[model samples]
Target: MGLLLKTLFYSSGFIIVWAMVGYPLSLKLIDRLYKGEQLKKDYSIQPTVTVMVVAHNEEKVILEKMNNILELDYPQEKIEFLVSSDNSTDRTNEIVTKFIKEHNERRIRLFEVILRKGKTNAQNEAQKTVTTEYLVMTDANAMMDKNSIKELMAAFTSNNIAYVTGRLSIVNQYVNEVSISESRYWDNDLAAREIEGRIQTITAGNGAIYACRTSDYYDFNPIQCHDSAMPLFYALQGKRAICNHDAIAYEKAGEVIKDEFNRKVRMSRIILKHILPDINILNIFKYRWFSYFYFGHRTCRYLLWLSHLIVFVTNVFLIKESWLYAVTFTAQVLFYLLGIIRGVTKANNKQLTMIYYYCMTIAAQWVGVYNTLTERTKPFWEKAESTR
Candidate 1:
């Protein structure tokens, strides 16, 4: 029992400390990379790029999305469009077929796959369908900014660029319930900005709203969190995943609090399925100060929250050092309860609200570990159902 408690204390303490230490290191690393040196100068030639969209039961919105792409200023010949329905039971197929037939003369080419390979498989299959040198993946619900593709292509000038992520703007936040719901839950606009401004890392990748080279395409595990996993994988390999703030895509946000919560939980599951134990030293150098900061600033910090829960629970009855264990466990529970109260109030102070939000986020992470461990698979995509 003493040995077990010792292990728990040491493990939790290490996680907490490591999470804090990683921040300053990441900042120093990012500073070095940003010093008068740009990697985009290497890709001298503009290469062929393909646009891929994965949709499931997006009958009402797919047509409008296709139209938006057609309005892009890029030469249709240099850019291609590939969209897959992934076993959609709605009129999604019919809508796509009509667009293909009507716009066959244009540079747009449409293909449909009926199998439900999840988002990752759909993206992989889309990559296989095209031999283009570059590939951009956008969501069916997202509408790209007029110059988004153009700006993204400009960044490829840096030869070291593997994957590029864009900004996602929730369209019409004024009155839409979905937009309002998103502003409070699931959406990471401010968090994304903080990451970009401080560490140059954007966690969202705006989902299907970003562009990357076909060669950099990685066949990640199907259930893995696509956005976070892909960028982190490349970043770990010592390449910077440039976050393009100017390149924007407008999409509908979650319509209700429940919808938003479900999206977060689904995303939480995906994240747990993917975060690996391996630590990359190259990632430390490539991102430099910011990378270290980000790992500490974001990634490692959350892991500590998970450790806190495990440690608190184990120390309760397993440790003979009752006073010390009780004190630590009590502190953890109190902080968590305070976070929950702050999160529930939804106050107007953005800073305090964000603090609450971050705390709740860690709480959600704990839930993720539990769900992942207990073999729970909430079948339907939570956010998608509302979008439908």
Candidate 2:
């Protein structure tokens, strides 16, 4: 029993450390080896593309999003906007309708739902209005760069490329401890996705800005996260999904830690319930490079909380075995203690804030796991108030 416990402790510790530190270093080291080749521009190629924006009570940012889309570098004649409102009680529909009237162009269309279905349902209903060859799916709150659409379309140079996701830039307008840590998280995520895309198909797309072939788009399960579901669906069809670093969309970070935690918990539950089952397409024997990228960038990441828990619990059992074990156990306890302190006091230290965020995120994932096991998490979407 003692031998087994010690072995488990060391093994879990090694994995946790490797994931936290070594894995990122490895990616950076091998980044140049798999760097994606730049595609030559064909100025004469103009594909008809539809931009779909799904909103529920998004009156705050809907107008800005519309204006952003209208200003995109893509040809207005070749591009169309499909704005869907999922039973918005607020002025969301009215605002979109006003925009359509003001534009007075056949390019802008609005689909208002009377009943509150979920985002997936709204997206599916809106997709039927799309006659374009390419689809650009974006959130109402995310504003795109002027050339984002053009950059995304440029990647569709080959038929084998099923989807192209844009870079998500977390704009911390109101800088605070939570915002700083959240920015760091997004930076790391973007880096990993860039590297993964260079190596092979990326694990998923940023919900803010992503494009896919209209023919390849499918109505996903309402319970599944659209960002992950769409990418995995394309992968299963033997199509490649790449991220266009040049295409950028901006979004605000969560101002409050609790709001971010709740968001992550919901996301974790959806990933565990829906995304995990679809990962079989990334079989090592079948899809060699993609399998390595997916497991390294996503699967192992999802299981990190479990690895952390194992290390902590096993460390407790081996605390008195040696000075090294005692130090390791003490460090774990102190790190958690600092997290609690940062939570209660709301300290501004970047390192402590990151640790607090990490611990809270793990706690949130545990709750998400419980919700998944009990089937308590529903398909309905809840907007994080802090981000809004």
Candidate 3:
């Protein structure tokens, strides 16, 4: 039992260290290899692209979404908008139908699917209708910059590129201190750097805007989360799925603090059940970076403050044996705990509110794991306006 515990401590410690060091090292290596390289552009041969949106009860902002897509700079003849209502009870379908009817003469092809389920079902239903060479999946609330489609298409210049993901900027930063801090967590911190560098696996942002070859796209089981499963499945196929820094889509963050917590819970459960569990061991060996990302970016993030406990207990034993080991372990635990504390407190004007927010995120992850393991049923979408 002592030997087993020691092995767990050592393995967990090495995994934590490798994850931190590997992220930057992977960035540096990819940058060195792809130096002076830019996305290849092919203006002469315009490939057909379909912009697919899966929405439900999004009447409040569905029109804004359509208007944003309609304003993209891509060729009208080359772009198609495949809109699915996903069994919306609100005026989401009616609004989109009216827009499509009015703009029928234009190049946009707007189709609706009314399903009694979540985004995964809507996306899978829309997949059959995509007749274009490439398909871009985006959320109803996701706002595309004028150049987003063009930038996404440029990455497809290499035939080996199976999919291209985008960066998300939270438009409603002033919503709340928690929402604002969450936005910064992505925009100002790790996400921005991950997108800028090459050989990306998974990124945490809107999960709203991503493009892929129509042939390469797979159906995510309705129970599965689209963002978590799709890219991971693509990775298993040994194809390059990239993150396009220039492909920017802006979206509103959660309406309030509790809304943000609910969102994290849903995301955490999906990552644990679908993404981390079924990953092929051989593929994990090949893309060890992604393996680390799965654990660091998704899995261990839930353990939260308990990570400090693990470090303290394990190192106390190692302390008498080697002072260097003790010092190194102490520094790592202090740095991460500090980051977590600062991240939480920064959510509001009060010094301690950031701590509350940090604990909230961590607690939400545990709730998610519990719900996932016990097979608890939770609604896919939340009534954010009601939360406000």
Candidate 4:
């Protein structure tokens, strides 16, 4: 019994460490040791592209989003602006129609899906109507740089490079300490994905700005988000889905911790509940590279809360056995105590709020896992009011 407890304690500690620090460093080391697949870059490849702005009751920002896309630097003859509305029962459709009527030379069109299916479903619907060579899928809230689509197109120099994701920046990072914490977390995430792409296929794509070939786009249900699921899908097909850091987009960060926490809960549930099985992640013999990276990128992080729980629990019983165990127990207690204080008092310390944000995010993953396993998860599109 003692040995079992010790094993669980040590193993869980390793998992926590790996998820926090070891994984990104290992990726860098592996990349340095063995340079992975290189993408052939030709900056002049501007193919016919369709920009699909997926919207769902985004009346507040739909007009701005349309105007944003219409003003891009891409060729007017080559770029088609598509406003894919997922049964938006607001002024969204009206605004889009007005924009189309007003900007006929910009080649803007609105496709309204009658069903209020989730984001992926809306993408599938949009793809069916795409007669272009490349399709760039982005959120209505994501404001792209003038050269975003041009940069995304430049990466598709090789047919094997079917998918390309862009860099996303939070526009309102200083809204509050919580926003600052989220911005920092996002920077780390973007760096990790960039390194992963440099080594091999990226583990996931960014929802803010990503482009894929019309022919290679996978048609998945609403339950599976294209942002995370498409990378695995392309990997299974022996294709490359990489990150182009030059393609930039900006989005508003959540104003409060609860808003961001709830958004993570919804996304984690959708991806964890169906992504593994839907893409056949366990078929290691066939998709070995994908299996390895997905584990490092998602599986480890999603299940990290379990390891943390085990470590804390095991340390409780082992504290009397050794001074090391007692010290670890105390440290863990203090760490969590600070997080609770941050929660209760809503502290303004940037560093302390970041720590609190980390803890709350870890807890959110467990809640998502619980929601998925117990069939209580809702895999649908429900935008956070705070973000809008």
RMSD vs true structure, all candidates: 5.0, 2.0, 4.5, 2.0
Candidate 1, residues 47-87: lDDT per residue as tens digits? 78888888888877899999988887676678888886777
Worst 10 residues of 4 by lDDT: 270-279
Q: Mind sharing the TM-score for model 1?
A: 0.75
Winner on lDDT (1 vs 4): 4
lDDT of 2 at 115: 74
Candidate 2 local lDDT, residue 357: 89
Q: Which of the predicted structures, 1 or 3, would earn the higher lDDT when compared with the native?
A: 3
Best by lDDT: 4
Clashes, model 4: 0
Model 4 TM-score is: 0.94
What is candidate 3's CA lDDT for residue 214?
Answer: 90
> Which is the winner by TM-score between candidate 1 and candidate 2?
2
What would the per-residue lDDT of candidate 4 be over residues 227-297, giving only the tens digit for each residue? Answer: 87888778878888899988999999998788889988877775464435545766778766567677777
What are the per-residue Cα lDDT tens digits for candidate 3 across 329-349? 777676557657765555346
Error of 1 at 239 (Å): 3.1
Model 1 error, position 340 (Å): 5.7
Listed per model in order, the count of residue pairs whose N, CA or C atoms clash below 3 Å is 16, 0, 4, 0
Q: lDDT, candidate 3, residue 106?
A: 66
Residue by residue across 1-388, what tens digits does model 2's lDDT show? 8999888887777667766677777778777665655443444657999999999999888999999899999887899999989899999999999889999965899998777767878888888878999999898988999989888988777788898999888887448988888888778877877776666677788789999888888988777767778766777667878888788999988898778988888778765644255657568777656666666666666777777898889888888888998999889999999999998888788889989989988898888888888988776667877776
Better of 3 and 4 by lDDT: 4
lDDT of 3: 0.68
